[model samples]
Target: MQRIVLFLLTNLAIMLVLSVTLSILMSVFGIDRQGLGGLLMLAFVFGFGGAFISLLMSKWMAKRSVGAYVIEQPQNNTEKWLLDTVKRYSDKAGIGMPEVALYQSPDMNAFATGANKNNALVAVSTGLLENMSQTEAEAVIGHEISHVANGDMVTLTLVQGVMNTFVIFLARLIAGVIDNATRGNNNQGGGLGGIAYFAVVFVLEMILGVLASIVVAWFSRKREFRADIGALEKLKHSQESQLEGSMMAFGINNKSKFISLFASHPPLDVRIKALRDSQ
Candidate 1:
C-alpha cells in the first residue's frame, strides 16, 4: 500500500512540475494556443521530459518504497555472496557494478531499475532469498543484469514517452473540439466552457492512460522474454534448470490475472515454455 501511494504521489508531483514548466515555456516562446504544431511540440517536450525525469528518480524511489538497504559492506555470508554474484555478472556484462540491495517482502520478487546500464540498482526481496536456492537466486540476478546490459529501462522509458506524447496531444485536441461544440450550442463563447474543457481532458487522459498502459504492458512482456534469454546466455549451460525453475517460481508465486492487461511480466507458463524452447 505504501508503494502504491508513493507511486501515485510521485506521478502527481511529476505532472505538477511538468505543468508548471510547460506553462513557462509556452509563455516564453509566445507559442500560439491555436497552433497545432506548437501544441504537438509542447506535448513531446513534457512527455519525454517527464519520462526521463522519472527514470532519473527511479533508484531513489525504489529504495524508499521498499525500504531497500544497499550493502556497502558485506555483513554476513549471504550478503557477501549476493555482492560477489552481482559483481561477477556485472563484470561479464561489461557494465558498471550496480548497487545491490535487499528489501523486505513476503513475495518472491526482484527488480532492476536505473537511468542507465552503468548506474543501476538490483534489488531482491528477503522472501526471494529465503525461498529460492542459491542457484535460482543467481538466475534471478542474471535476469536483472540482462535488463541493465540490454538497456531495457531506457528503451521502456522511450516507449512510454512516445505513448505519453500521443495521449496528451489527442486528449487536449478532443477536449478543445468538445468545448468548442459546447460553446457553439450555448451561444456563449467563453464562460463555463473552460471548466468543461478541463473536465473532459482529465477524463480523456484517464481513459487514454489505461489504453496506453496496455501498450506498455505488451512491451514489458516482450522484454521479460528477452531478459530471460539474456540471463540464460550469461549463466552456464548446466544452470538451465535453475533458470527455468526460478522463472516458474516467480510466475507461480506472483502471478495474478486481475489486471493482466497492465501486467509488466508475461504469464509464468508462457515464460517457462519460452525458456525451454530456447534450450
Candidate 2:
C-alpha cells in the first residue's frame, strides 16, 4: 500500500510539474490564450504518444540492442518445459502468457516489458540461467513476473513521458523569457544573451532532473517491495522455498555487476529485508 501510494504520488507530481511548466512556457512564448487548450492537448499527444510508441517498439529495441533471441513456441522438450513453466506462472498470476526470450548478458539479470499484461515479454540472461539454482531462478522469475503483473513498466513510462514534457517546457520557457528581457540590447545583451539564457535554463533543468530522479528512485524502491510481496504470495501457492534468500543469493552472486542507475530494481539487501520483515 505504501508503495502504491508512493508510485501514484510521484507520477502525480511529475505530471503536475510538467503541466504547469508547459503552461508557463507557452505564456512566455506569447501563445494566444485561446490556443492554450490546444497546446495542452498537443503536449499530451507528444508526451503519452512518445511513451506508448516506445512501449510498442520495446521488443524490437531489446532484440536489437541486447541481441535477444525469442524462443518462438519453444519446440523441443527442454524449450517446452521452460515455456510450460512460464505459462504456469502466468496463469497463477492471472496474467496472459508472456513471450519468454533469452538474452546473452554476463550480468545475472532478467526484465519483463510490454504495454499491457496480455502483451508482455520476459527475458532472462544467460548468466541467470547458468548461475542460479532451479529454486532461485524460479524466485527471480517470479519477481520479474510480478513487475509485469503490477503494470510497473507502463506506469514508469507514463511518469517518464510526463517528466520529458516538463523538461522541454521549462527549458524553452526560461530561454524565451530571458531572451525577451535581453532583446534590443547590443553588448549588454544580444551576443551573449542567448547563450547565457540557455546556460541558466540548462543548469536549472539539470538540477531539477537530478532531484526528480532521486524521487523516482525512491518510488522505484518502494515498488520493488511490492513486487517482492507479490513474489512471496505467488510462492505460497506455487513453491515451498523462502523468497527472502533468493534476492540475497542474487546479490551475493552478482554484486559486482549491479549498477544502481541502470538498474530500475532496488538493491537485493533492501528487497530481502523487506520480504523478511513482511513475512
Candidate 3:
C-alpha cells in the first residue's frame, strides 16, 4: 500500500509539473489554444517526454529505493555465484551483461529495470537468497533476465506514453469546454470560473489515469506469463520442477487482492496454472 501510494503521488507530481511547464511555454510562445493540433502536440511533448525520463532514471531510483548494492568485487561465495549466474543467463538470452545486486528485503521479491535491454540492473532480495534453494533462486533470476531480454520495461514505457497522451489531451479538452461555458464570452482568466476549470481538469486527470492503469496492468499480467515461460525455457532440462514449485510458492505466499487491479504481476494461482499448463 505504501508503494502504491508513493508511485501514484510521484506520477501526479510529474504530470502536474509538466503541465505547468508546458502552460508557461505556450504562454511565452503565444501558442493558440483553439485547436486540437496544439493540444495534441503539447500532450505528446509532455507525455512521452515524461515516460522516457522516468525510464532513464529507473535504475538509479531502484537502487536508492531498495538500497541495492551492486557486486563490483564479490566479497563472498553467494555474491560470486549471483554474478556468475546472471552472466550465464544473459549470454543465453543474447543481452549484454546486466549489473547484479542484492537488496536487504525480507520479502521474496526481485525486479529488473533499465532504459534498454543492453543496459539493465537486476536485483534480488536477501530474503530470496536465504529462504529459497539454489534451484529456486536461479529460476527467479532467470525470470528477471527474461524481463530484460523481452524489453518489457521499454514496451511498458511506450504504452504509458500513449496512455498519458490521451489522458492529458482529453482532460484539457474537457476542461476548456467547461471553462468556456462557465465564462460565456469573458476572456479574462483567473476568476472563480478559471479555478473551477483547473479543479475539474485535476480531478478528471486522476479519474482517467486510474482507468488507464487497468490497461497497463492487463498488459503487465500478460508479460508476467510470458516471462515465466521464458524462464522455463531458459532453464529447461535443469530443475524444471523446482523452478515451477518455487515460483508458485513465492506467489501463493505473497498473494493479495487489495491491489490486484493495479498489480504489475498476475495472481499467483493464475501464474502457477499457466506454468503448469505450459508444461
Candidate 4:
C-alpha cells in the first residue's frame, strides 16, 4: 500500500517536472508544443514499460548469475529466526515479504532487487556470512530489506528508462518538425537543420542524463542512511548492540581495493559516522 502510494506520487512528480521544463523550452526556442508533447508521451510509455519489464526479469537474472539458493520458507529453528526478522522488519517498513536467497561470492556485498517491494529478492555474498557474526549479518539483512521497502531499484530503473526514451524520441521529433517548418526558405537551414537539431538534442540529453544520474545516485546514498537507521532501530528495539558491531565488522574491509565502486551500500566510515552521530 505504501509502495503503491510512493510510486504514484514519484511518477507524478517526474511528469510534472518534465512538463514544466518542456513548456519553458518550447516557448523559449519557438518549438512546436504538439510535437514536444507527442515526443514526451511516447517517452513516458516506453520508459515506464521498459523499466517495469526489467524489474520482472531481475530475479531470474540474479539467480542465474549468482547461483542463488532460495530456501523453502524457513522450516527449522534457525531458519525461523531469519524469516521472522525479515517479516517483522518488512511489516514495520510497510512492504511485502521478499524471497530471501544466499549466494556464493568472494566479495562482501549484498543487494535487494525486484519489480515491487513485495515480490523482491535479497541476496548476500558468502563472504559476508563467513566473516561477520550473526548480529552483523542481521544488520546487513535489515539494510538490504530497506532497499526493497524504499523502492530504490525500481525508481532507478524508471528514471533511466525515461531518460533513454527521451533521448531517442526528442532528437528525431525535433528534427522532423524543423525540416517541415522550413520547407524551401533557406537551403542552408534545410540542409543542415536536421544535423544541428540532432547535435543539440544529443548533447543536451547527454548532459542532462549525467546530471539526472547524479540525482539518482544522491537519492541512493540518502536511502542508505535511512536503511541504516532502520537497522539500528530494529536492533535497538530487540535489545541487541549487534547492529553497530556488525556494521563495524563489515567496515573492516581495507583489503578489498575496489569495494567502493562495486558496493551499493555506502562506505563503512560514512555508516559508522552516521550511526555514532545518531546517538
Best by lDDT: 3
In order of listing, the candidates' clash counts read: 0, 0, 0, 1
Q: Ten consecutive residues with minimal summed lDDT in candidate 3?
A: 240-249
lDDT comparing candidate 3 with the true structure:
0.73
- Please give the lDDT score at residue 37 for candidate 1: 92
Residue ranges of candidate 3 with Cα displaced over 4 Å: 1-7, 185-192, 227-254
CA-only RMSD, every prediction: 6.0, 9.8, 5.9, 11.1
Pairs that collide, model 1: none
Q: Provide the overall lDDT of each model, using Cα atoms, as 2-decimal numbers.
A: 0.71, 0.60, 0.73, 0.58
Candidate 2: deviation at residue 213, Å? 4.5
Q: Which one wins by lDDT: 1 or 4?
A: 1
> How close to the true structure is residue 5 of candidate 3, measured as C-alpha lDDT?
65
Candidate 2 lDDT tens digits, 32-145: 333545555556665666567767877566555556788987767656766777888889999999889887655556667778888898877766666655666677777778
TM-score of each: 0.82, 0.67, 0.84, 0.60
Ranking by lDDT: 3, 1, 2, 4
By TM-score, is 2 or 4 better? 2
- Tens-place lDDT per residue, model 4, 1-279, is 454356446544554454445545555756553466666765666556655776688777676656778766666765566667777778888988888776665555566777888899876666665655667667778777877877777777776676657654665566566556765665443433534655555555545544554554455555566444443333322211111111211222222223233233465457657877888
Cα lDDT, model 2, residue 272: 64
